[model samples]
Target: MTRLHTLFLIGMLALLISTPTFALTGRVINQTLNRPEPDIEVSYILHETGDVTVVRDTTDSKGQFILDVPSDPGAEPPPMLFARYNGIDYPGNPAPAGDTVDIPVFETTESDTAISLSSHHILLDAQAGTATYIFIVHNHGDHTYLTGGDHGHGLEIPLPDGVTDFIRAPQGVHLHGTLLVDPRPIIPGNSQTFFTFSIPPSNRIAQRITYPTAGMDLLVQPTDTPVSTTVLRDLGDVTLGTNVFRRFGAEQLAPGTQIDIALSSPETASNLQTPIWIAATSMVVVAILVIYMRTLKTVPNRRTILLEQIADLDERYESGELSEDDYKNRRNALKAEVIDLSDSN
Candidate 1:
């Protein structure tokens, strides 16, 4: 072959070989504004090895970036690519070359306007001199609400005076005297808090609160389970029931609104079987199973769900429920499943 022709053929072969490496293109935008977000950092994380390959460019003025993810033939499965913005990561769908990926990001803002009480379940243990309060706080707004210090998202709840101990607070919340303060930012979604504390024995228990939003579903346990019997002093807008009193509607609780629940031990109140407590005990199992089922939809889903399950299992094992052998076995099984699923994909 002629020298000129040989060089041209070699150049063409190199171009063909490099084409697949530059297949993925991405764009980042402000979800609420539908505008390009420039100068935001992005990353490509490998699914298998946890190896991260960062791109050279942040989103340009047009909120666009291109990544050259070359497939490793030596790796059992082609490494999946993930696009990360800020701290949240998003998986990339496998697509043909030149396909553009759009990533939407929202700017975090402090706002209490969208805060609402989705559910409030109160359980009073008169025998133990304690009360358990479960509150599901929801943020319906587009921005996040930060808690703690001045100018924070305020959710001030007043406890009955003379409480001895603050037993538990959810991961993000902190106990301050008789009040609960969430130190983490409440993302634009539902976050739950379980507050348990000791209180002085009294015929009546009152809950007072001033929140930024209106409406809440209040559930007070009646003469059922191990908890003591509690009667609503004033029905107000609540609908009475035998085992639990439920109130759900657009009943706006004005600031300093107090809900008084009177406690009385009825003759029929009895301790239920221990098996009935399975609902709470099975949370970890249920969470793992749900994640497994959700991941069955796709390989990427499986990878993410399995990783989450592994983390949850570690936490559960550390809490002393799972033995070392059991934890290692389960973790290994999940890792193998992840590998098999990735290989299949």
Candidate 2:
């Protein structure tokens, strides 16, 4: 072969060998409505509509889920992905954080990534009497610097006093007691969202109360790195009226998570309503007493006689210093008159 032909053939072979390979890539994440929940399920799904397509997935266990999609070279540009996991529909698997692609794979590493949340601490409001709080440590995908394994997102909350009664938490679910302000985990590069929970009584309002007087400390794990930020909130005042308290913050949660709270005061017990039978009996007793008092036509005569008797006994006891026995006998006679008056009614 000529030297030029040999060189040309070698270059072509190198080009064919270096071409990038494409594969199916995706992940399933499971999650629940509650935090710190355990045993969550992550389901994956996909759907197509006409020429367009969408894909999505979710979990009952602490909101964990995954999405795996295979790319087809036969499809036109911008393939579609869809999913309907546990009744939630995603026209297309929303890209995580900063990237976007309808197809599961185009060109990327780590095809599947799992995401979930962990509950760290809860806060309470002493003055406003509302329990306001935040769930810390929600995990997302790996960033360039903070690899998905590194630093994730965290939430902070300032709880007001007197709102929730008992809270139930399951694994992977963090159940907040009464909440003043419930904030969603601040996804990096996303707009902030909040969940507003008020104490039962609408009139009882809690406003800006000073944040943690001692302040809060953020300690990152794997290393003892401490994050410092002073937490504060406006305290609210109570008005005269009915107050509502929460029973369960998150209805659905993972299993096996512990639920509890440290309180400023024990929750007030609910009062039993007055029964109809008891109310009617009391009303009849009151009516009888009222009628007896009104019908006492000889009240004046009775009052005069009792007064005279009492006066006579007092004079006798003081004058001769009547014997103790005689004085006691006469006093008893006078006391009977008063007792009679009460009994007549």
Across 1-345, the per-residue lDDT of candidate 2 in tens digits comes to 999999999999997876332332333332222232223232222212122233334333433344454344342122333333322222233343334333111111221222222322222222222233332223343321121211222232324334443232111122244322222222211111122233344323232222211121111111211112223121222211122112212222233332333332323223212364334322322232222223332111232333444554555577876677766665565455446643442
- lDDT of all the models against the reference? 0.52, 0.31
Candidate 2, lDDT over the whole model:
0.31
TM-score of each: 0.49, 0.20
Best by TM-score: 1
Candidate 2 stretches greater than 4 Å from native: 1-45, 48-154, 165-186, 191-198, 209-345
Error of 1 at 165 (Å): 4.4
Best by lDDT: 1
